[model samples]
Target chain A: MKKSFAILATTATLACVLANGTAQAGATLDAVKKKGFIQCGVSDGLPGFSYADDKGKFSGIDVDVCRAAAAALFGDAGKVKYTPLTAKERFTALQSGEIDVLSRNTTWTSTRDSALGLNFTGITYYDGQGFMVNKKLGVKSAKELDGATVCIQAGTTTELNLSDYFRANNMKYTPVTYDKSDESAKSLETGRCDVLTSDQSQLYAQRIKLATPDDFVVLPEVISKEPLGPAVRHGDDEWFDIVKWTLFAMVNTEEMGIDSKNVDEKLKSDNPDVKRLLGVEGDKGKDLGLPNDWVVQIVKQVGNYGEVFERNVGQGSPLKIERGLNALWSQGGLQYAPPVR
Target chain B: MADQQGGVAKPPFWNDPTIRSVAFQIIALCVVVGIGYYLFHNTQTNLQQRGIASGFGFLQNPAGFGIIQHLIPYNESDTYGRVFVVGLLNTLLVSVLGILLATFLGFVIGVARLSRNWLVAKLAMVYIEIFRNIPLLLQIFFWYFAVLRNVPSPRQSLELGDAVFLNIRGFYLPAPVFQPGFWVVPLTLLVGVIATVVVRRWAHRRQEMTGQPFHAFYAGLGLMLGLPLLAFALAGFPLAWDYPVLQGFNFQGGFVIIPELAALLFALSIYTAAFIAEIVRSGIQAVSHGQTEAAYSLGLKPGQTLRLVIIPQAMRVIIPPLTSQYLNLAKNSSLAAAIAYPDLVSIFAGTVLNQTGQAIEVIAMTMAVYLTVSLSISLLMNWYNRRAALMER
Candidate 1:
């Protein structure tokens, strides 16, 4: 016990030195560059958002966000290591500098941004709390969910949303919460619960993995706005700007009809807007502390935002979630990015 | 030769053993305390520098999640403080229940292990070896997953006399609802309890002073039961049991024991009882064989010899280690978080800490609660040990 305490004290002391004793500006980026990689935190196993395959390789939009950031910084997408964290452990991992960027499907909330010493870079996926019920139950909607036994995943916004929806409708229900989503799904499959509540995309993702996927149906109700994003620690504005703009750069490339396939050809085009963005007429990466070809490396390596989505959660993936709220602003969606130039 | 003969003279203060020992202790204490203070201050400064809020104010904010089981009233809009209370109560409920069940089962197995019957002893031995060797978490998973398998879903519940129901969701029994003037029944019951105690004492006095035996057992039992029955008759049977009815998706209006609680209770008691059985067996064996022989020579029955002579003496050896086992059971009850029992560690340290981002404060409070609980158990066992101590004087 004494030895563990001594070790803990030494660690805390080292953490203090790293947090305050080092050169006060751009420390995270400097450390990342020195360490030769960026430590990125993602979900433990959220399907299509960071779940690992049988080969232990992680794929999803969240993982791509980190790869895009890494490619922009080091020009090598592989120069990033993944740390999968649970919902409860994600914020602390980011705040403690255990990971440089928390690209997990974490919702951007006011309390988390202001109080937890975290600054959300930008929303990567717009999600909402939804329910998945067995088809045999014949429950039509969330309103008809009165007196239902709802299985919810702990440490997420779904639990709170379920409670609120039930209370608002003057209904009573039992919430059987579990730490892992798989456990909740198992309970639902066994008829232990009448409803399984989670983000809509997650419901679809979990549905396909069920023993009989056709038995479950995702409800149409979208209860709460969960703008999932990547977050950086509070002190490093330079690092924060890099992380934020990496995502915006991807979205802007999508809006401008550029992708990994046509990026080299687009460099030869005469469009002034594209020229300034691609560092042909103007260098857009200097202020953000990057090289002139950072955007080019990102596009070449990670593709545009739409491609990431389609490859991970869109038609190319098993989830096949539509980009309803995630399309570009020109397409009358919520995904609007500021002009690059 | 003269100095050796006169060596009993008082030594100088600096060279004295007492003074030197005291000095070393003071130095050691200062170093320990200084390290503790440095660690605490360093944590506060680091937390502040990192801009994470560091205070107990978050506990007053609303806890926006729901718990599956709460012994008291709870709502989603309640404060985090209420959440802590709910989690603490659930933890205590599980720990206390587990301890009681483990003690009972442990004593039974422990005594049976020493039985002359070969099959019974071997059965007890097998049970100990099987349960003690397996990990408690896996056992919990096994019980929770495989439990209620034969029981159908809520739509096809197994009913008991049209008042109780058992299904996949839980086991539900009729909940007792008291109507107007129900207090009269309880008040009469309490009166009967007091009367039974007084009658037992008087009977004991008569047996001792007049050399005549009284059937205080039957008299006490009669007063305890007959008075309650009489009160119910006079008060027009003011108690009613509300039966559980099948509702939209589950049963409603019943006292339901959720599967999580049942699975947790089974795992905790069965696992802890294995260790406790060994402790109890050793305790009973520690008592000399001569005591049993002497009791038998004095014309005592085998049952009396075991309970009156063996158990009383065995308690002295049992209690100290028994306290440790009880503490283990209580601390291990935190594993309830695994299967969603809404215990203190999960609800308070997990969900509350996540929502508020007060890891340090939440952890400190959780550790303090466990320490308080363990210490309370230790103190209680110590008191009992003192009473059961041998009176050598």
Candidate 2:
């Protein structure tokens, strides 16, 4: 009787394992395609990058990328589910398949690329660590901040860079660390620290929170290069390629003078690169295992990269960050996408 | 007839009815182990497929970050292991301080709740209810945002004499600076503690033999204080304090308790104290009214009755829940992440997790640290409770 019971339990376990193993692994992609939506991870509440509105509607430059991806796949930019993630939970959420893509102004680093099973498709925002001090402090440059108390957000690259910059310059400073960006900025304003340091964009966002915007001035020192970008999980190569090509296509479309407003008319152009991009000449879509008019759908539905950038973070927006490093490669920027062919 | 010998007839090992139960237990254990192994294997495969490493080697790498509040000296060049230690020490510091403050305030409020003064009782009740009902996270935010942020800057800091200053930057006060021979202080403290222990043993033996009270408290006080002072004097007065000086926009020389630590401590203490107040109130109330009346009837004054009779008996009921409150305070210190206090959770779990991208390792380390702290506190409390109970018996 005991022997039979042992045999039965072993059989049951084996059957369960077999059943799970036999299930199709492409269920995630299938569900995404069927629902015609992409669940994207975004910042919980960082202004100028990703933030929820008064009604809790998520919007930002990061949000635009996810929308663009959905538009490239399903021909509708509105078909995106935004999942708000904190700094700690963002990578895990993507790896766990909780979100299809992460466009949360996350920095691209070697560890994340190799150790977190993440693929950073492209750099969206070029930022750097900077400092903001009260104008009344009479501090013109960060070099003058010897023994100054600095309010820094803990668990960020800024903390590391801040230390490196201070140490390299032979300056002494005390850090008052806080977990959240808002708290650190608040502490600095309240005189808990002499200065607040973070990404240059974040510095601008946080400075406005001061009692008077003119009270604080961001020091003109770019401490460290912060190449922020969008990422997807590593296991799904096909999905990774799709997200990567979608971003590249947008930038390429903009560089080739193709845009949402004129994509339909541009299809008749004689320019070979433009024609191929518009699905007039080659099997670019077939090679990528996508529809023949992938770029067309992306441009028409999500607009070109220039449009997305201008609408979210460029001159048309409050942040108004210059497209210096985010400009096309031909325009003396780092944003170079591979050819479609 | 055979059943009558031992109330039952047991068969041989293989054929016994209980054998099936043993077999079932073994099978269940195997199944659980198998499932656990299978899941682990799947996770390993998944991680391997994505080229992600699963290990703890990252702990020894250069941390590349500087810590704000460290008990031990740390630098950006230090390994991540050192940073972990720094974070662990900070967490322990807050937990210890919070426990001390919470217990003190909790006892006061708890005693106040049982006071005859109507106004005092109602005020204690109001405080307990208000703090106990609201979330600790909300309280942390309220203190960090509404209270601490509203303080004036260092240049115009609200000064308390020349020794202490209250500013939004933090509490700037005199830090006890040790001179070259400062090691003598800790040595003195150790000698004092040893002397106190020796005297206590002697007093206990004397009491056992003579059946008389040996004034153990007075004896302990004299030995501990006298020995420490004598050592300090003999050791050439090894310590001096460096008072905080306001220099332009910042305080220099002396230690400044950062606002993050202050806010975290304040929030944790107040929140934990409320629960402790309830525990204290219930503990005191559980002591019979007859006991209080008997003390009064014995010509004891109100304060004396509380100190000598009521509080000691109340402690018997108060200690167990009070232990839990202390543990809660320690665990809640992890919420220091919300305010960026550089606690173990924030530094190790938040920052290290991001830097290394080893979520499982970082989280496991964090959980293990908290677990060890919580367990040690509870274990120590249990020993104290046992001793207290033994004395009562």
Candidate 3:
């Protein structure tokens, strides 16, 4: 009997190993529920993307993604505890299970998705690497900025991109990397470095925080594709589905013209797509192990993708970034979500 | 036989001190092993469950990053293994510079504290009290942000005959573009240095055997300097200066010292020198005053008294504590990460770990490097300590 039981256990383990994606299916979800909150990893400070005020309140597009995930699980956006991480510390924090979802402004890369054992749910923000220079330097183009000292944030894709760009262009540069965005910006402001390079959106976000934002100009050169997204650890398919669908639900609702302020009104709509997205007609959340009103909860709490974007990083906010590539597919943008049903 | 009285008895097995102690050690050993095994097993299981990659395999992967300071040549396409070496070299470079500067400054301030002039001793006292009390990172910020950041931009660089320039970007000095046969200078210098050491040793032996004095300092200095000068003339001046020139955004084709390196070096040396100065002072004071007086009464001048009697005895007290200061300075060099100095902790443990996501392996490797550096320092200092220890025939 003991031998038979051991054999059964070994076969079960083998099955789990074979079906790698289903390994520890509901482990994170159960742990998160038992702890009564989602552990959301975010950036320490990047104004429109993720920043915490002195009151310890976090507000950004990344924070809203975490909030949507929390609302889907616990029906309350407040059921999340934020752990602000530096760029270097974000992935390790997620892998160690110190946080359930890394909603920081982490770029989606092939190496990160495959080798690092992370699954990027979706791209929440589309960005590109760019350069920002002090206007006094008269650096009109990146090509003319060769042999310059550039302050960059450490542990970022921008560093590699900068290196590749310079090497490809046959130009020489000195990269002085900093741990925080503000520090890099400050270096540029203080004349210690000739330019600051980061994602163009981040360059704008960092620009407004400077003492004289108007004195700096972002060079008109988009160097690399940066699809900033949220990521979760590999395995735990059930948890992965829930976090992933949370963002997609927002996108789907936005496509159906449902938002946080109009979510209740939309729940009473007779349109099939709207009803399905609001979780009124279809049990959209059943397979993901969430309640039927999961979509409703998310839409009511964190708003749809366009609403969150506008409020945080888009025209409604200080960053004034246009919803170009991040807009809906029908509007000639890249944010296209699958049908709810 | 008489001492072996019948009334005397051996303790019971439980009460046997040796047996009890051995059993206790065995139990403690099991506990330690059990804890270590549990942690290792737990980590293995967790990593497998998360599908996170583990092991030293990532070191072979491309580092995919550029560093500002690479002591050896480096490229972005270099493997993580090379990044580790580059980072280790930078850390060693800064630590060596800081150690040399701190030792010199510390020795000067230490002796000055014992000067007959009241103002000199008080000023040294103030310096030690102020610098050692503050933190090292703050001083690094002060140097990088407050001081170096205020330097003029490259367009408005302060230049010395256009060969050297000071700018916000960095301190640019003319790089030596070595032509054919420039290696002779360094070769001659090396040979002169070795010859000087041999001559000094011979001079000391002769003085001990026949009480005949030799001016070894003047002779050795002349040999060391004169040989290098002669080699330069014979080599036909096989060196050219690649002076920095104003380019588009910055000076080009020159040797540069980025402010990050300068700030970290200054902060580390100044901060550690304060502690080392106090140690030197205490070590000197630990020697008896009678040693100096005895040398003076034996017809020794003040310089000879210090060189022959006081310093040798003081070194015995100084070496042990000075070893700790050296270790502290080396370990404290990790704070260069705060200001982007491309030290071991920043490049390998910071960017490399982030890129690879192999936290356990990368961190363990970094910690191992620091441990090896500290252990080697302790071993060298202890050897020197033993040599300076008192000996009797």
Candidate 4:
């Protein structure tokens, strides 16, 4: 009995000591670096955002962000390990160090930032809540959905927003909520819900998957602001800066009209701003603790912000999401990047 | 000579076999404790280094997210502790309903498997084979995705009689809006149960003393029904029923169960019932044929023979496995997450974990809740099983 007590006591003491001292520093970032790869969390399957193709290889706008991070760090985009997570699992995975960054079309919210301890790198997609209903319902406006059954994905801002919208309008609604976006979309497609509410981008993705794509129409109501972005775990200042700046670099490159294809040509430009951005003059990379050609490497490897968006989710793709608020600041949109110098 | 040899051959504590075994056990225990301590210490150290708080003080903070199907009143400002309770209650709600439904369905199918009629027996066999072969998760998805998802819109809802409306959204029925004066109904029912127990005790005592069978069931039923009717009259007929009605596009003034909950419960109950049926069948078969034959030989009718003799014996084998099946059903309720029923796991483990990013605490709390539920169920079932076994003896 005495021996057992001694063992328990020692165990307790050691647990306290290790928990207090040994495990809390830059261990996570160091581990990632040592492994020569960054683990990125992505959506399980959303076309144009993050989805597997016929060969089961992931390719999307979010996937490119992970690749760019890897290229900036290791000079190889393929060094990223993609961990596909559902909406419910994505945040926890980031918080628990299961993944280094979450680029999964996650909305930037105050609660997520402060309460969940996540830092939004920057908004990638400016989205808004929209409703899609079958055309045969003859309801063209969201105002007509007073007593309609709305299918909303649970554990999301969408559910809360949907509730608030209907309550404010003094209209009653029964919400059929699913844990996954696909399930909720499926429910709407199969007529389990009168209307499906989600980001307008998601609505477009879901619409095409319907048996008759022309049967459903997205309503004109933009209910809430959904600024989706890449998020990093809190307390890793260095890693957070690397991710944030990488995204900013892409946006700035696009604004300067220096894309992946013409980046090498633009390196010889006489423009002082373009020259400095291409690492011709200033030592910006040294401050960020990256290679002097980090921006060049990122652009060469992942393309400019506009190119990535077009290839994955915009005009060149099936989703066809217009560059609305996501357009460049010079083009009258919300996206603007700080000067590299 | 044996005593002398035994005394002379006594070993020292270090060389003694029993002493060595104890020593080994102590060493193993120490090693496990050391590793556990190392892990705990490392985690705390890391959290501290990162300036993260270790304790569950975060539970008191406001859960900014809202739940879809809260049985209790909740808002964005509700505390995480309240969310835990809501989740626990939801779990209990599903378990209780699943248990009752599974029991009813299992018993019928179990008896059908051994039916004298060929069609009945064959049908029960088919039901068992088909349901038991599929995974529960797939079944939940199929029902939620392929079946319930196809229900009609509220404007064109399929009406099952005038009392129920089946729509893409949910099942709407006249929600029982309890009147204040309707309290006498439940009170009367409680009185009826007490009256039945009193009459049953009287009947049993009389049977023991005089060796004559008394009609305890009928007399108990009479007292139970009489008291309730009398109470209802004295209370001036306080009870009223709320009839569900359709108004405009959707049904109003009715209780609604969303399609998610419906799909989850439907899939869980049907899938679990198949296994329960097999248990019930084997339980009945475990009782010898002689028990039934002997009961019939004593001039008892088929119903009486089977109920008094066969069932009593069969229950001995049934209770243990039946309890396990109930527990399995309870655990499987976690699959409600797939269909988004806002059950304990979906709301707390999935949503709360995502929002809070406290994987260890969230998972631990979830596991603890389940453990408590499973243990409580087992404790209750064991008590009943003991009583049943004692009666047989």
Candidate 5:
């Protein structure tokens, strides 16, 4: 017993020393600059959010957000690396400085914003909680899903929204929850659950992963609002601003009718708004501690917000999700950005 | 020689053994306290810097989520305290069931390994070797992902005699619903148990004093079983079974065990049983052969010699390691998180911790739980070990 105690004491002391040596807290921007790359947290393998292809190249709306941030900072979108995190690890990863930014399709909630020391930059996808069921089940709407078995991902807003929706409708259901969305989708596919509930965008993303994607149909009832966006740690306001404006620049460029394909040609235009946005007439980037051409770099490298959305998850992608609430405000939707000048 | 002859002066304080021992103990205590304080300080600073709340007040907040399996009545409207209880009860349920099943299977396999029949021994050896070699997590995955996933869907469930059904979702068994007068059965069973204990003591005393045997086992079994059955019949069989019927999407009106729970239970019990079997075999073998021979020389039958001689001695060797195995199985139930079994670690530590961002409170509570369980098991086993230990003059 004495010998074991001695060994345990030694191990504990060693562990303490190692832990103290590794924990170096500082400004996130300084760390990112020193490392010469931004470590962005992303989803493990959500298809239209942040999935890696067969050769390990990540391309999604969230991935593009990270790329846009990298472009604004270093003028090279390739200078960003991805750290895939699950729903449970995303916040802790950012708080620990393990990742510079989190673009993992996380929802913005008042509790998360104020309580968890996180700041959601801007909305990338406007979504709502929806249900998906097998065609053979003959369940056309969520109201008809009384006493149904539902598969949901734990530790997510979707789970809470699902509970609230069912309770409000005076319906009863059994929830079979999984830690990963993929597993929940698989459970739905195998008929272990009668319905799968999540954000509408995620349902579309997960549906295509099924063995027979055509066998399942997403129900029309959207139950709760879900504004998904990128987030950053709270203390580093400068880093937060940079990440936030990178997204804003994308939105503003799209609103200005300038995209990656025409950004270079639009720079030569005589429009004062275009001149001011492209850094020819104003110094909007100076206030942000960035280069005058930061917006130009983001637009040139990562394209406008619409282009990224369409290419990754919108009409041009396999998900084919319509831009219902995510369209620009002038075009009858909620996505509106502040003018650069 | 001169100092010894002169009645040696007192040793210096630094050189004194008593002083040195006390000093060393004091230093050890200080070190432990220092380290603990340092960790606490670091955690407080980190939590403050991160702006995460540090308290147990979150437990009173509504959970706002649904749990598939709960021992008591629960809903999304329940508080996080209820969720904690639900998670803890589910954990205890799995651990208790796993321990009972593992112990029984372990003893059978252990005895089979020592059987004189070559085939029986070889088969037991092969089973132990295979299960013990594979990792427990992989076995859980194999059972959940490979085996359970391939089972038929609810529409094409594998039915057994219109009573139970198996499908990819879960297993459905008849649930017993008892009427008001069902209390008589339990009351009779309790009486039978007390009577059995009294009879056992009387039989033991009679055998010790008069050297005569009593069939206490038969008497106890008859009383226990017959009394409950008689009471049940007298009450006009006030128990009914609720059988599952094929509903819209799944089975309705039955007791359902989710596939995750089933897979976790099977994996944990099967994996732990292999190690337990080895421990039991070694323990039995550790008993000297001379004792068995001595019993045989006394004209004791084989069964009597084995039970009255071997088992009593082997228990001394078997119990300490057996306690460890039971504790291990309890701790390993945390792996249920991987398969979504809604155990304490998954629901409270994993999901609740993530949602509330109260890492310190949640983790401390979880650690406290495991520590309490381990210490309790050790305390109980230690008491049993003390009684079973060899008494020396």
Candidate 6:
């Protein structure tokens, strides 16, 4: 009986191996063009990053990044399809070729970049971990939360940062974790936890979901640097360059004082830099295996970096987060782009 | 007898059934092993090419995440190896409690379904049908998200006398704080158990020899209860109960069972009991009516008929399927990931796997745990099944 059982187990294991044997490699660009749609991965429902409206239309800064990619490829921003993934599912989805570009609010860490077989293009949002607490707790600072219970989302850098901060300060805390951001926020609202911790941008996004958003305040302590960006699979360098340069063009357009409303007029400008960026005086787009008009399409359809950020997560939207660290290098921020020439 | 009969001396080795069977088995074994090696080789190459680590070294790294409920000592500074152990223990904790509760509830409801009273039987049937039809994941969500969320907060908790409190967070029960001289209580209990066993054996032999019944049940009960109480009085009751009190935003000074754990336990037991009830009911029904009638004809009471004749036979049919239900309950506890309960799947497979980016190693370890647990349960149940088998001449 034992021998037969061993035989059966061996056979089952062999069958599983055969079933999972297919490995996709290094043709994402061709595949995307053939399918005529970019398979983009986004967060499930993180407002200001990736969220859907009541009619099921996805709109966020990350969503606009995918739109820009779609416009660069097909001259149509609506040709991209979005697949909402949880924090735990995003990496595996990219590794298995289930999604072409992972534009979810994922942090770029050294370990992930080196070990996860993925390449992050550029920073889309500069965020840092922060804490939000109920005002009724009468806590002025995070140091007062020594013995508090905190609500945190699992499978994110925020969890690790919270642990490090508490341990460094010689404080003890109880963490009640949830699979989704909104669930953790709900737990906080229901008084199950005294504090909620996440990226400062996400704290604002989640706070708005509460019945009384005004009752809670984000603590004034930014704990860790979180450079959120879009990532792609590792084997295709051509696809990598396209995604990387697409982001740079957006930033460069913003640096040159270009917006969606003024893009048409700038196309006729005599300025050498504007002409080169608008793809009228250079072959930089052609060098990246795209048409010379690619940048024009992206700028016309998805707008510049400032326009997308403001409309989705800044002064034009409900989040109203300041562009403190996301402004261009000319404006004394870290967002500098190489010249288009 | 040494050779073959009624033919040429024995078929050649190639044509012999024994030789043919051996050859086929050898070929099959070789094929399976070859495929296994090929798969392993391919995985190694893929991992190297992708630059992902493919070893167990990550187990030594600090976990840096907190688990809400851990049976063993754990902190954020502990290693991933410790986290894995904590996760395994929590999984076993839920599975064991769920199995015990489900079995007890299953037996009661199964018997209630067979009751002669119309309302009792109908009620049991309704419960069985309702829970059995719904998906287990949906039930877990309903309990964790809907029911627990509606409970009152800690400051306004529903107090159960002065010993227990219930709220949105969970139940807080008074915990016993043992003093230095508390060893005498367990010692006395052990002595009482040994005395009961000796008395029961003596009574059994006495009844067998002289056909005079002995009251072993009452005598055993007295020793078990009276000895403990007497020991407690002699030892000055070296224990104190610490009740939970509202402190700031939550309760303190007692054993608090978190809402996640409670919701998971409640959902698992209730869902598993429905299927176990069906197994138990069918097992009892499988026993023939003739056995009960024969016991009745021998002037046996209804209780004696059930204890002596009906139950032993019913257990033979019940134990096999009942083992499967227990295994199912244990595996279903993995669904605790959906509700963020920090079971083995949530902490190790979900969080740890994401952090390390080592999918192959993490998943293999997780699968190995489940496989080992299942095999152990099967081995134990099979032993009991063999002992309970009917002997024949």
Best by lDDT: 5
For model 1, what TM-score does chain A reach? 0.91
TM-score against native, each model: 0.92, 0.91, 0.93, 0.91, 0.93, 0.92
For model 4, residues B182-210, the per-residue Cα lDDT tens digits are 78878888888998898889888988999
TM-score of decoy 3: 0.93
Q: Per candidate, chain B TM-score?
A: 0.93, 0.88, 0.95, 0.92, 0.95, 0.93
* lDDT tens digits by residue: candidate 2, B83-180: 89999999999999999999999889988987789999999999999999999999998998888888887777898878888887788878887778
**Any runs in candidate 4 off by more than 4 Å, and if so which?**
A1-8, A15-21, A24-29, A136-147, A164-172, A286-289, B1-10, B16-26, B50-54, B64-66, B75-77, B247-249, B390-393
TM-score of 6: 0.92
DockQ of each: 0.38, 0.49, 0.37, 0.45, 0.37, 0.37
lDDT of each: 0.88, 0.83, 0.89, 0.82, 0.89, 0.88
* Interface CA RMSD, all predictions: 6.1, 3.5, 7.0, 3.4, 5.5, 5.4
Model 1 chain B worst lDDT run, 10 consecutive residues = B26-35
Q: Taking the tens digit of each residue's C-alpha lDDT, what string does model 6 give over B139-210? A: 998999889988997778999897899988779999999998889888888998999999999999999999
User: What fraction of the reference interface contacts is present in each model, in order?
Assistant: 0.50, 0.51, 0.53, 0.41, 0.43, 0.37
Task: Please give, as one word, the docking class of candidate 5.
Answer: acceptable
Measured with C-alpha atoms, the lDDT of residue B276 in candidate 4 is: 85
Chain A vs. native, model 5, TM-score = 0.92
| Cα lDDT for residue B232, candidate 1 | 90
Weakest 10 consecutive residues, lDDT, candidate 3 chain A? A17-26
* lDDT of candidate 1 over A60-153, digit per residue (tens): 9999999999999999988989998877777778877899999988889987887888899999999998989999988788889888999987
Q: Give the per-residue lDDT digits (tens) of candidate 4, residues A28-82.
A: 5577789889999998788888888888888888898988888777778889988
Per-residue accuracy of model 1 over B1-393 as CA lDDT, tens digit each = 998989887888999998799667655654565556656776776676667898999888988888888999998999999999999999999999999999999999999899999999999999999999999999998888886545699988888898888898899999999999899888988999999999999999998999797989899888889998899989899999988999789888979998888999999999999989999999999999999999999988999898889999999999999899999999999998888789999899888888888888998999999999999999999999999989798
Number of colliding residue pairs in model 6: 0
What's the true lDDT of residue B286 in model 3? 95
